[model samples]
Target chain A: MNIYLRLVYRNLRANLDRASLFFELIFPLFFIFVQGFGLNGIVPPFEIGNGRVISYSLFLAAGAVTLTVINGGTNAGTQLWFDRKNGMFEQILMGPFTRAQYILSIIFATLIIGVAGSLLVFLFAFPVLGASFNPSLSGVLTIAAALFLGTVFFGAFAIALSVALKSSETFQIVSTFAFFIFLFTSSVFFPATSAPSAIQVASLANPLTYTTDIFRAGLFDAMTPTVSLELGILALEAVVMFAIAVIVFHRIRV
Target chain B: MGVNQLSRLYGDKPAVDRVSFDVERSEVFGFLGPNGAGKTTTIKMLTTLLQPTSGGANVLGFDLKTEGRKIRERIGVVQQQDSFDQGLNVETSLDIYGLIWNVPRTERKTRIEEVIARFGMEEFRKMPTVDLSAGQRRRVQVAREFIHDMDLLFLDEPTVGLDPIVRRALLDYLKERVHKGLTIFFTTHILEEAEYLCDRIAVINQGRIVQIDTPENLKRRFGSARAVEFKLLQGSSEALASALSSSADVTRLVQDSGTGAYRVTTTRPESVIPEIYRLAERHAVTVSSIYIAETTLEDAFIHMVTDDENGRETERGLG
Candidate 1:
C-alpha cells in the first residue's frame, strides 16, 4: 500500500501542476462554454423523448463533463507510455512493487483526476448554464458511481490500446481518432433516438451512449425505463475492460 | 552465487550459451565483452530481469525460477542504457526510488543527502532530469540505486558517459562499498576499470566464457608475449622480415605504416631485442630507436576474443 501510494503521489505530483491545470480545469471549461453557447443558438433543444425539453447547452454540459473523464483515462495511458519510454517502467519493475501495483496506481490516479475534472465541470455549469445540481441521494450516488466506473472503463481501454501499440505516435493517432468517433457515435450531442439510423446503430454498440444516458438521467432527475439494464451493461463492460487491462499489463515486457 | 550451465536462447540462437561461473561473497566480478556479447543477457538472468532458457542458478541461496522476487529484493541494478524519470528532479527521483525500496522516510532523507554529496550532484539536485546533461543524468541514475540497501549490485557499464574524475570517483566509491561487504557484478568494455576494480575477470565472447581469472593472472597467462618495436633508419626491403622470421622466439612481425618501423612480438623480448639489432646490423641497416613494450590487458582481450572467433570459424569449416 505504501508503494502504491508513493507511485500515485509521484504520478499526480508530476502531472497535476499549473500547466496540467490549464488542460484539466480551464480547457475543459472552455470546451463547455464553446460547446454550450456556440451551438445553443443554432441547434434546436433536445426533446429527450419524454415530453420534457432541455436546452442544447445543458445536454452538452453533461457530455462535456463525461468527456473530461474520458480524456483523463487517455492521459493515464499517455503517462504509462512516457514511463516506459523514459525508463521509469523498468526502474519500478526492478523495485519491490509488483506489476499489478503499478497498473492499479495508474488507474486510481486517473480516477481521481477524472472525478476532479467532473466536479469542476459541474461547478462551472451552475454559473455558465444557470443549471442546478440539486439531486436526490440516490441520483448523486449514481452520478458519482458512473464517473468512477466510467473513468476506470476508459482508463483500462486506453491502457489496453497502449500495450497493443508499440510507438507513442501511433498510439496518439489511434486514440484521438477513436475518442472522436466514440463521442460522435454516442448521445453526447443529441438523443440516441434522434440520431440518424446509422449512428443509432453505432451508438447502440458504444458504451458511451449508455454512459451519457445514465449520467444525464442522474443529473436531471429524468430516469429512463431501461436505466437498470444500461447500468448493468456499463458495469459489465467496465469489469471486462479492467480485466483486459490487467492481463495486458502483465504481458508487457520490460 | 553459483551458476550451472545457465543459458538464454533467442529463437534458435543462444544469446547466452551453456556457461557457468561462481561469485564469492563480497567479490567484484567483472564481466568483460564487446557489444552484443551476452554480458547484459547474463546480468538480466542473475538479477531476475530475464529468466534462463535452459539451465539453473542460485542467487543469494534462492532458485532463479522460483524465488525471483526474493532475489530482486536483495539486489540493485544500474542498466547500461540511460534511464531516468524526465518528470522528476534529481532529488525527487532519488526519493521516489527509496520509497519504492521501502526505505523509511527519515533514513531515506539521510541516504539521499549522502548519495548526493558522495556523487557531487548538489548543483543539479533541484534540476529536472531531462534538463540535465547526459553525464549528470547518469550520475543521478547511479546515485539513486544506492538509496536502497542491497546485498548485491549489478552495474552494466554504469560509467559510460562520466568524466574521468567522476568515473574514478565512482570506482573508488564502489571499492569502498565492496569493503563494506557488497558483492558487485560489473560489466564494461574498458579494460583499465576491470584491472583496477575486479577481483576476478571473465571475458565472454560469442555467448561463451572465453577466459576467467584474476586480472593479473590473465595478463600473465595470455599477455606474456611482449612487443619489440623499433624504427629503421633506412633498410628493410625484405631482408629484415626474412631475418626475423628465422628466429624461433619471434611469433609475429609487422612493419609500421609510413614510419619505417617494425613491431616484433616474442615471448622473450630480452633476447629478441638483441636478435633484432643484430639482424639489422648484419643486413647493413641502421637502427633509429628500439624499445620493449609489455603487452597490455586490452591487447590480451582482443587477442582472446579474436582467437575464439577464428577457432569457431575453423570448426564450422571442418564440419
Candidate 2:
C-alpha cells in the first residue's frame, strides 16, 4: 500500500472510538430529527430562493449534513494535537513518511469521514422529511463539490489552528468556540437572508454559509448564478486554508 | 555508520557538540551518559527525527542530510518517550505500527505474535494501551518496534520502567538479533547493562564524547586504582587516614564518618594493606575486616565524568 493510504487507514482505525462515532454520526442525526422536527411548527417554511418553499425540517436536514462534515473535519484535524501529545507525530515522521504525506493523510481521512457521515445523515433525513432523492448531473456535481470543498476547508482550518496553538487545552477551547460561531452565524439552521445586516455580513464571511447554500441549491434543484459564486468562494477558501495548514505544519518541530 | 563533527544547537547553545563516532555492523554500540548528556539528542539526529545544525553523518552508506528518507527506510528507532495509539489495544497498536512500516498483513501477524510472546504481553495484549500500567505500556512500545524489520536499531533507554527479569530478557533478545547481523545503537544509564551487552561503549558528557572504548578497557584505563576499605575495631579512623595519606601507593584516602571506616584508593592494594597493618600494630590498634574493591564500568564512568568536570572548571578558573 502507499504510505499516504496506510497513514489514512491508521488515522481512521485509531479514531474508531465511541466519542468520535457519536459526535460524527449520531450528533448530527439528533439535530436532523429531533431539533428539525421540533422547530418545524415554530419556524415557518423557509424560501431557499427560486420559489421552492420547504419545511424547516427539510431545511435543517441539509444543515445537519453540513454540520456533520464540519465535525468530521474538525475531529480529523484536532487529532494532530493528540498525536503530538502521544509522541506518534515524531514517531511517524521517523518512519518512511514526509511531512506532506502525514498532513495530507489527515486531510484525506477527514474527507472520507465527512462524505460518509453526510450521506448517512441524508439517508436518515429522507424518511422524516419525505424528501425526494433525484438530481441532474450538474446538481450531483454541485453537491459533491460542496461536500469536498467544505470538508477540506474546515479540515485545513482546524489543522492550522492545531499547529499554531501552543497547548491542547487552548486548541480545544478555541476550536469549540469557533465551531459554535460558525454554526450560529451560517445559514445552517435558519435563513441568513432574513437575519439582521450584521449577521448577514458575518454569514457572508463564513465558509460554512457558502457550503450550506451550495448544498441547499443542489438538493432543491435551485441552481442559480449566486450558487456558482458561492462555490467559487468556497473553493478559494479551501485552497488558501490548505496552504496555510501546510505552511504552519511545516513550521512545527517534530 | 559514521558521524563526523555532528552537532545540534538550540539557539546559541550546543546540545550535541561536535561528537564523532562509528558503529560497525552486527555490533551493539552503547552510548552511556548522565542526564541531559546529549545521548538522546545524538540518537534523534542519527535516526533522522532531528536535523543537525552543522557537520555531517553517513548512515548505512547514505548521506544524513540528503538521504534521510532512505536511511529511515532501513533503520528503526525506539525513542525515550512513549508513543502509541492510546485508543487501540496492544495488538491493534502493534499491527497498525507494522502497517505504517508497510509490513505485509500475514507477516505482521506473525511478528506481532512473536513479539507478544517474547515480551510477555499475552495477559494484556487485548487491553487498551491507555489502561495498561507504565511498565506494560513501555513493553508494548518496545514490542511494537519489532513488528517491522530494520538493518540498524536505535534504542534510547529502552529498558526503563522494566523489571530485572524483563530487562535481562530484552538485552538477551537484542544480543540474539545482533548475532544475526543486526546492528544496535543503544543508550542507557545502566552501567551493568552496558557492560553485559555493548561490544564497545561511548561515554558522552556536556555534549562531547569523553571516552569511547570497550567496557573492560575503559575500566582498566580510568579505574585502574583499586579501593581498599577497612574498619578499625580498636583504632581510631583518624590515625589510619593520617598514616595512609603519606604512602606513595595511596593516591586518595577518605574516612566514612557514619561507618568509621577508612577507604583508600591506591595503585597497589597489596602494598597498602600490609602497610596499614604495620601502622595499626605500631599504634596499638586492631584492624577488623578489610577488602579490596573491584573496579567496574560504573566506577570508570564516574571517574571520567568527574575528571572532565574538573578540567572544565580549571579552564574556567584560569580564563
Candidate 3:
C-alpha cells in the first residue's frame, strides 16, 4: 500500500507544471470548461441566469467525471510506452516485486488521478460558471460510487491498451478514436434521450455513458435511465476491463 | 538463485543462447561482454524481465516461470538506463525505491538517511536529479540497490558514463558490499573492469563466449614475450646479425626502416640486455632503446584472438 501511494505521489510531483491555466487542473476539468463555453454559446443567456443553476452545474460536473476517466486512463497509459522506449519497463519488471504490486501501483495511481481530476472539474464548474453544487445526502454518495467504479473501468482499459500498443503512434491513434467514441456516444455532449436512436444504443454499450449519466441522474435528478441499471453497467465494465488488463499485462515480456 | 540453460529469442535469433550460471551466496560474479553480446539479455532472463524461450532459471530458489512473483521479492536490479523519477530530488528518489521495496515505515526514514550518508550525498540530497551530472545520478542509481540488503543485486553496465575515479569508487563500493556478505551479478563491456574486479572473466564477442578464464592464467597462456629493438648506425648487418645469432638468445629478426634499427624477440630478456652491449662493442653499431620490456594485457588479448597467420606477426600491433 505504501508503495502504491508513493508511486502516485511521484507521478503527481513529476507533472506539476503546465503551459496553460488548464495545466493547474487535470485535462478532464479543462475539457469541461471548454464544453461550458460551448453551452453558453448554444443556449440563451437566461438559461444560466435562471433557477437552473444546479442543472447546468451538474451537467458540467458529469462531463468532468467522464473526462476524468478518459484522460486519466490515457495519461497513465503513456507511462508504459515511455518505459518501453527508455528500457525502464524491463528495469521495473526485473525488480524484486510481484506482478500484482506493479499492476496495482499503476491502477491506484491512475484511479486517484481520475477521481481527483473529475472532482476538481466539478468544483471549478460550481463557482466560475455560476452553478450550484448542493445535492441530497444520498446524491453525493451515489456520485462517489459511480465515479469510483468508472475509474476502475477506464483505468483498466488504459493499461490493457498500453500493453497492446507496439509503438506510441498506434496508441495515440487508437486513443483518439476511442476518445471520440466516449465523447459522442456517452451523454457527455447532451442527454441520451436527445441523441439519435443509433447514438443512444451506442451510448448504452459505452461504460463512460453509464458512469456520467448515473452521476447526473442521482446527483441532480437530471434526465437519465434507471440509476440501478446504470450502476450495474459501470460495475460490469470495471470487471471486464480489469480481467482483460490483467491478461495483457501478464503476457508482457519486457 | 539459479539459472539453468536459459535461452531468449529476439524475433527468430536467440539473443541469449543457452546461458547457464549460478550466483552463489555473497559472491560478485562479473558478466563481461562486448556491446550486443547479450549480457543485458541474460540479465533480463535471470531477473524475470523476459521469460526464457526454452530453458528455465531461478532466483533465491524460486522458479522464474511459475513463481515469478516470489522471484521478484528477493533480488535488486540496476538497469543501464536511468529510471529514477527525475522530477524528485536524489533523496526523494531513494525514498521511493525503499518505499516500493515495502521497507517498514519505522526503518524507512533511517534507511533513507543512511543511504544519503553512505553515498556521501548529504549535500546533493536536496538537489533535483535533473540538476545533477551523469556521475551523480549514477551514484543515486547504485545507492538505491543498497538501501536495503536484498538477496541478489543485478547491475547492467553500472559504470557506463562514469570517470575513472568514480568508476574505481563504485568498484570499491561493490567490494566493500561483497565483504558485508552481499551477492552481486553485474555486466560490463570494459575489459579493464573485468581484469580489475572479476574473479574470473568471460569474454563474449558476436553473441558467443570466446574465452573465460582468470586474467593471470589467460596472460600466462596467451601473452607473448617482449620485442627487442636496436639502432644500426653505419654498421654491417652481417656482423650485427652474426654477433646476435651466436649467443642463441634471440629469434624473430627485422631491420628498422629508419636509422637502420634492428628488432628481435627472445625468451632470455635478462641476459639479452648485457649481450646487446657486447654486440655493440663487437660490431660498433649503435644500441638504442634496448631496455628489457614485459608484455601488457592488451597484447595477450590480441594475440589470443587473432587468426593463426596474424598470430605469427602479432608483435606488429605492439611495435
Candidate 4:
C-alpha cells in the first residue's frame, strides 16, 4: 500500500478507537432529522431567485449536509493537534515520509470523513423528509464533485488554522466560532433573501453559502441562481486554501 | 557516522556547540551529559530533525542537509519522549509502524510477533497503548522500531522508566543486534549502562565535548585520583587529619564518626600511603588495615563536569 494511504488508514482507525462514529456519522443525521421533521410543519416554502418553491425541510436537509462537510474539515485539525501533543508529528517527520506526504494524508483522511458524513446525512434525511430524492448519474457526479471540492476547501482552511495557531484550545475556539458564524450567516438554515440585509451581504461572501447552494442544485434538482458561478468560486477558493495549507505546513517548525 | 563541528543555536545561545565525533560501523557510541547539555540537540542534528546552525555531518555516506531524506530512509530512531499513537493497540501500533516503513504484510506479521515475544509484550499486545504502564509503553516504543531494517539506530534514553532486569535485557538485545551490524548512537545519563554497553563514551558539558575515550581509558585518564581509607588505633584523628591535609598529594581528609576511620582523597595515592604510615609512626599510633579505592566512572563524570563548570565561572569572573 502507499505510505500516505497507510497513514490515512491509521488516522481513521485511531479515530474509531476514540468513538468518533457518533460525532462524524450520527450527529449530523440527528440534525437532519430534527431540522427535517421539526421545521417541516411550521416553516413555509422557501422561494429561490429563479421563482421556484422548495420545501423548507429539503432546504434545511441540504443545510445539514453542508454542516456535516464543514464539521468534517475540523477533523484534520483535531487529529493534527493530537499528533502534535503525543509526539507523532515529530516522529513521523523523522521517518522516510516527507512533509508534503504528511499533509496529503491529513487532507485525504479528512476528505473521506467529509464525504461519508455528508452521505449519511443525505441518506437519513430522505426517510424523515419524505421528499423525492433519487437523482440521475449526472446529478450524483455533481454532488460528488461539490462535496470533494468543498471538503478540500474547508479541510485546507482548518489544517492551516491548526498549523498556524499550534494550540488545540485556541484552534477549537477559533474554528468553532468560524464554523457557527459561517454556517448561520449563510443560506444553510434559511434563504439569504429572508435574512437581514447585513447578513445577505455576509452570506453572499461566505463560501458555505456557495457550497450549500451548489449542493441544493446538484442533489435535490432545486433551481438556484448562478450555479456555474458558485462552483467556479468554490473551486477557486479550494485551490487557494489548499495551496496555502501546503505551503504553511511545509514551513512549520518540526 | 561522521560529525565535524556540528552546531545548533537557539537564539543567541548555542545549544550544541561545535561538536565533532565519529563512530565506526556497528559500534555503540554513547553520548553522556547532564540535562540541557546539548546531547539531544546533537542527536537531533545527526538524525536530520534539526538543521545545524554551522558545520556539517554525514550519516550512512549521505550529507546531513542535502540528503536528509535518504538518511532518514536508512536509519531508525527511538526518541526520549513517549511518542506512541495512544489510540492504537500494541499489535496495531507495531503493525502500522512497519507499514509506514513499507514493510510487506507477511514480513510485518512475522516481525511483530517476534518483537512482541522478545519484549515480553504478549500480555498487553491487545491492550490500548494509553492503558499500559510507563515501562510497558517504553518497551513497545523500543520494540516497534526493530520491525523495519535499518543500518543505524538512534536511541535517546530508551531505558528511562524500565526496571533493571528489563533494561539489561534490552541492552543485551541491542548488543546482539550490534553484532549483526547495527551501529547504535545511544544517549543516556546512566553511567553504568554506558560503561557496560558503549564501545566508546563521550562526556559532554555545557554544549561542548569534554572527553571521548573507551570506558577504561576514560576512567584511567580522568580517574587518577584515589581514596585512601584507614582506621587509627590510638592517636587524635584531628591531628592526623590536619597533618595529612598538609601533604601536596592529599586534596581532602575526613574522619567517619561511626567507624573512627579516615578517608583521605589524593591525586598521588602512593605518596599519601607512605606519608600516612610515617605520620602514624611519629604520632605513636598503630595503623589498622588500609587500602586504596579505585575511582568509578560516576566520580570521574562528576569531576569532569564540575571542573568544566568551575573553569567557566572563573573565566567569567576574570572577564
Task: Specify the highest-DockQ model's number.
Answer: 2
Number of colliding residue pairs in each model: 0, 0, 2, 0
Model 2 Cα lDDT, one tens digit per residue, B128-154: 988998889999988888899899999
Cα lDDT tens digits, model 3, A138-252, are: 7777788788888778778877887998888998899778877887898776767768999999988988888887777655644334777778878988999999999999998
Among the numbered candidates, top lDDT falls to: 2
Q: B1-319 in candidate 1: lDDT tens per residue?
A: 8988999998999999988999999999999988899999998788776779989899899998998888889999998878887777899889977876888999999999999999999988999888999999999999988999999999999999999999999999999999999999999888899999999999999799999999888888888667778888783548888879779887678887777678777768889988878887788888888998778677577667867887999999999
lDDT of 2 at A211: 93
> What is the RMSD of candidate 3?
8.1
Q: State residue B284's C-alpha deviation in candidate 3, in Å.
A: 23
Tell me the lDDT of model 2 at A118. Answer: 92
- Model 3 C-alpha lDDT per residue in residues B47-149, reported as the tens digit of each score: 7777788889777878889987676777788888876665578877777667666777668789778767766688899998779888788888888877765
lDDT by residue for model 4 (B1-319), tens: 9999999989999999999999999999999999999988888888888899999998999999999999999999999998888788999999988988999999999999998988889999999988999999999999989999999999999999999998999999999999999999999989899999999999899899999999888888878667888887762456677788988777667777888888777678888889999988877787878998777676577667867887999999999
| Rank ordering of all candidates by lDDT, starting from the highest | 2, 4, 1, 3
What TM-scores does chain A show, candidate by candidate in order? 0.92, 0.95, 0.83, 0.92
Clashing pairs in 2: none
Candidate 1 or 2, higher TM-score?
2
The per-candidate TM-score of the B chain, in the order shown, comes to: 0.84, 0.84, 0.71, 0.82
lDDT measured at residue A61 in model 2 versus the true structure, 0 to 100:
88
Best by TM-score: 2
Error of 4 at B237 (Å): 17
Ranking by TM-score: 2, 1, 4, 3
Residue by residue across A165-224, what tens digits does model 4's lDDT show? 958899999999988898888888888878999999999878888888888877776545
CA lDDT, candidate 4, residue B292: 88
Say which prediction, candidate 1 or candidate 3, comes out ahead on TM-score.
1
Please give, for residues A107-173, the per-residue lDDT of candidate 1 as tens digits. 9889888888888878877566887667888778778878888888999999999999999999999
Instruction: Pick out the ten consecutive residues of candidate 3 chain B with the lowest summed lDDT.
Output: B303-312
